[model samples]
Target: MTFRDVVALWLVKEKRATDVVLAACDLLVAGEGGEAVARLAALTRLEADIEVPILLPEVMRELDLPHHSRGTVEGREEGLRAMAVRVLSGELTPRELTKWTHRMFGHEDEGWRLSELDDAYDTQAVDSDEALDAEVMAEVRRITS
Candidate 1:
């Protein structure tokens, strides 16, 4: 399938702000503008209450887009890496990673895919706790290392 088709599918299926943000990030990274920007704008209009702010500061400045923190459900590894960087840099908490990872677990191969993290991805417990956070952090360490 085409990249746009994949993104369109993600928008239709997930319709989450994170998905939009991640798609926008991918567009920015690929140097796609004009039609891409229009597509994202159209997406924001179609999806109610989606956070339109871009996540990466550099991308925001370069693209002149709004700023916010947020992903696709194929970019799983990239999403994990981004979250891991945030966790290691004190920008994101372990609890947050745990939550995001669990959410992403549902979209494997549809929105995103993972090999290294596939087995360990959804291993996080349902309950939130320090120990759970630690488990997530260990997973983060694995991603980063």
Candidate 2:
């Protein structure tokens, strides 16, 4: 595999390990060794990126990152804004942008994002969610008239 893919894989693994260790520490702090063991065992069965926000301060400390950092959030918002611009410019397809938005932001409403773009361009909404409603309304009027 390429260096980029390998680096991504390593980061994923590191995050999972950190999560598992943090989980154990949490349970131990609560005086639940048995629960810790059980939870740790279950975690070993799954390959996932789990994050406990309350434990993140410690994790950030270990990583030499500030506990309360806005740079990351601001950077992410800028990235999404850039992606929106690309979609509007046809540099990225709507389908691809929708997928990326969902992956990046977890359930961001794509139609709403597209609507923002339509407004920005002073154009009619393209590929609108109202297509079905408009068609159904047309049929209803036809039947009534």
Candidate 3:
């Protein structure tokens, strides 16, 4: 999908700000070498009102990505690396991440339910920390570590 389409999907369909941020981060990371960095810079500018200090780091941790302090080049790079790791590890698939972002950041729909996505993707079964097996736990640790 085009960058604009990805942004539209995240904002219009996901409705969760956190999801949108995460998906955007993933896209930035997956793009061409320096392109990801440039995309991230642009996204940060576009969402400046969203407050990177309060959002990006937490989302990074949630996605099993790395965290960095705000407003620094190193922090930006680290955050992107974290996003890349999450994408590679199956912790967050691109499509699933996009869908979640659409719901999280998009307009509010009182009828929206996380379960709806659950049923549609059948992919979030791994999100539960309590339900993970030893192997899964190890993978989680590897991702976090």
Question: What are the models' TM-scores?
Answer: 0.38, 0.28, 0.22
RMSD of each: 10.5, 16.6, 14.5
Lowest lDDT 10-residue stretch of candidate 2? 1-10
Candidate 2 per-residue C-alpha lDDT over 1-145 given as tens digits, one digit per residue, 9 for 90 to 100: 2211222222323223444454555555666545323444244323323433333445444434334322354334434444544445556665454445445545343234433433433343554535533432332233223
lDDT of 1 by residue, 45-110 (tens): 446244343323443454564333334433455445556666788977866665565566654552
Could you give me the TM-score of model 1 versus the true structure?
Answer: 0.38
Question: Where does the lowest 10-residue lDDT sum fall in candidate 1?
Answer: 110-119
- How does model 2 fare in lDDT? 0.40
Native RMSD of candidate 3 (Å): 14.5
Best-to-worst ranking by lDDT: 1, 3, 2
How many collisions per candidate?
A: 5, 0, 15
lDDT of 3 at 139: 36
The residue ranges of model 3 lying beyond 4 angstroms of the native Cα positions read 1-48, 76-145
Q: Please, what is the whole-model Cα lDDT of each candidate in the order they appear?
A: 0.50, 0.40, 0.40
